[model samples]
Target: MIPSNKPFFDDTEIEYATASIQSGNIAGDGPFGRKLENKLSDYLECKHALLVNSCTSAIEISLFALGIGPGDEVICPSFGFVSVANAILQCGAKPVFAEIDYETMNLDPAHTEKQITTRTRAIILIHYAGMSCDLVSFSELKEKHGLYLIEDAAQALGSKLQGKALGTFGDSGCFSLHETKNLTCGEGGIFVTNDDNIAQQAEIIREKGTNRSSFLRREVQKYTWVGRGSSYILSDILAAVALAQFEKIEPILSSRTKIAEFYQNAFAPYNYITPPTIPDGCKPNWHLFALRINKLHRDIFLEKLKSKGIGASFHFVPLHSAPYSKTKLKGGNVSLPVTDRVASELIRIPIYPQLSNAEKESVVSSMEEVAEELGLE
Candidate 1:
């Protein structure tokens, strides 16, 4: 079967990881880790980049470093990964769910502005499917309200908007390097920021709320407990693997771009399905290719694809309607019309750098057949 997603890796990752292990520095923030961070900072053009264990950890650390806690409300799109809301809740903050624009599956700037209030401390903007949201409008809102902006750039490592990197626009940005992502280190993440104060605080928070980072630089005679923090650092071994993948980002993104273009062209003839839209001046990494079926049920389409040995799946279930968000966060009855519609109609097909041309043709042909069977075209 053609899998929904596959991470690309080769002997280069193995060699780097083996070297990291042999160097007796498999701990966090080692040489490999530092190198990876430097590479990320340089590529993203951000002042500081801190490696963390997961995107969730990066979000949590960013929240802590930004002084977001109890009594704060963070506005985020309900149609996204549960990790965003969970991280907010973990930091003693309330996650205010907002609607998304059906076109890009990213937060709707107008609707997001409506959710802001006196208690709203920040807005978490997710670059859904590696396509940027309306950063210009969001930046205006940030300036108007004097609020913090955090980017959930988990899928937007190489994506850009108006010539600026997606992760660099916000006060703090988080990225994922999970096995399923475009870049893979098996499991890892990074936190980035341009603010000097936030960077210093993030370092302290990542190092278990101590001054150890300073001590390592010999700026402090001894390290000690400094503030509230946790062990959010990524291991050197994982960093080595991530560095190997980082070196191949251009080729990886190029391969995915070609696959996305193929999908766009292949599905253009069918009026029953709508392919993802790329906004003006927004360059996507093509992390995922999600099609919105207007007539057929998404599940039926997915099952048909599966029966044809083509792996297809649905994306996120809206967080507001999720069990935890409903029962615990009292968001069960939230009315996010676009979020609900997109969640039900959207289906993800296989789009990975490792997907061969033959596999791509097979997937497209199978999808076309399924659409015909469903009387969609």
Candidate 2:
């Protein structure tokens, strides 16, 4: 059966991991971890990059570093991964759900600006499906309100706009290196920022509220408890694997881009489905190719793909409508019509760099047959 997601890896991953094991430093934040951190900083062209256990931890520490708490609220899209909003709740802050641009599946700047209130301390914009969001408008809104911007760039490691990286546009950017993501270390992530002060605070919070990072730098004679924090560091073993993947980022991104373009062109003739849209000046990493099918036929399309031994699936349930959000999220219930509609109609076919061309053709041909059988013409 063709899987919906599969991570790409090479022999280099095993080689580096073996080296890390023989080095006697399997703990977190060791030599390999430091090396990976520096590579990420240079790749993203950001001033600081901290390798963490997961994207969730990266975002949580980012919010904490910004001094967000209790009375403050963070606005994010309801159409994204739950972790985007969960990070805010973990900081004792509110998560205000915003609507999305149905075309790009990213946060809609107009709808987002409307969610802002006096309690809003930050706006977390997720680059849905690896496509850069409208950073121009969001930057304007951020400046107008004087609020912090955090980018959930988990799926957009190499995505950029006008030559600037997606994660660099915000105050703090979070990236995921999960097994299913474009790059992988089994499970890992990184937090990035340009501000030195925020970077220092992030290092402290990631180290469990201690000044250990400073001590390691020999800037301080001794390290002690500093503030609220957690052990968010990635294991050196995982960092070693991540380093190997980072070295081949270009090939991985290029392959995925080719697959997405293939699907886009193949599905364009079908009137019942719509391919993903990449806005002008945005270079996507092609993390996911989420096709919006006829709302009435979306469920059947998934089942048909599965019956044919292909793994096609839908993405997140709108967070606003989730039971947990109903009770936990402040400002009561919200009605994001666009978000709800897109969530129901969207379906992702098997997309990975390793998918063979014949396998890709099989996926598209299967969909075409299914579409005809369902009278979707």
Candidate 3:
């Protein structure tokens, strides 16, 4: 059976990782780690880039670095990954869940603005499926309200909008290098920023609240506990693997884009389903290829695809309705019509870089069969 996703790797990754291990420096922030950070910074054209253990860690560290803590509220899409809300909560802040735009499955800028309040310190923009949200609108809101804009760009490593990288638009951008992402190092993440102070604070926070990064540069004679922080750094071995994967990003993105285009063309004639929509001037990495089907048919459609040896699945379960959020977060139980609708109707098909042409055909054919069986549209 085709799996929902798979990490694409080869001998190059193994060689790099082996070399890192043989070098006797498997610890965090080592040579390979520095190399990966530098590469990411150059690619994104950001002033600073720091490697962390996970995107969740990157978000939490960024929050702390930006001074978002107790009594502060962060506005985010309720239809996104739980990490966004969890990270805000970890920093002693409240998560004010907002709505999402059905077309892109991203936060609705207008609804997000409505969620803002005096206590709101930050707006976390998640680039859903590597498709950008309305950055212009969100940026305007940020300027108007004097709030911080943090990008949860976990799936947007190669995505760009209006000729600029997606992650660099915000004050702090966090990316995931999980096995399922286009680029992988088993499990790692990156934190990037253009602000000098945020970069310094992020380094300190990532190093467990110490000035070790400064000492490493010989700028400081000794490093000690200076502030609140955590051990959020990534290992050199993983960084080595990540570096290898990073070098192959263009090909990986190219492969995924082809698959996404194929799916879009295959399903365009089917009135029963709606394929992902890309806004003008937005260049996506095609991290995920999702279709919006009838809410009543989504579950059975996934089951049918699985039975046909095709890996298809539903996406997020809107955070506002989650048991934890409903009970723990204030205003979390509030109504978000768009978020609810999209969560129920959305279905993600296999679109990884390693998916073969035959596998892609099988997925499309199986979906067609399922739609026919269900008498869809």
**What is residue 352's positional error in candidate 3, in angstroms?**
1.3
Sequence-dependent TM-score of model 2: 0.98
Each prediction's whole-model lDDT (CA): 0.92, 0.91, 0.92
Model 3 clashing-pair count: 0
> Candidate 1 lDDT, tens digit per residue, 16-97?
9999999999988899999989999999999999999999999998899989999999999899998999999999999999
Span of ten consecutive residues with least summed lDDT in model 3: 325-334
Local accuracy of candidate 2 as per-residue lDDT tens digits, 324-357: 9788655637999999999999999999988999
Estimated TM-score for each candidate: 0.98, 0.98, 0.99
TM-score of 3: 0.99
* lDDT (Cα, 0-100) at 234 in candidate 1: 92
192-241, model 3: which lDDT tens digit per residue?
99999999999999999999999888899999999889999999999999
Give me the displacement of residue 116 in model 3, in angstroms: 1.4
Clashes of 1: 0
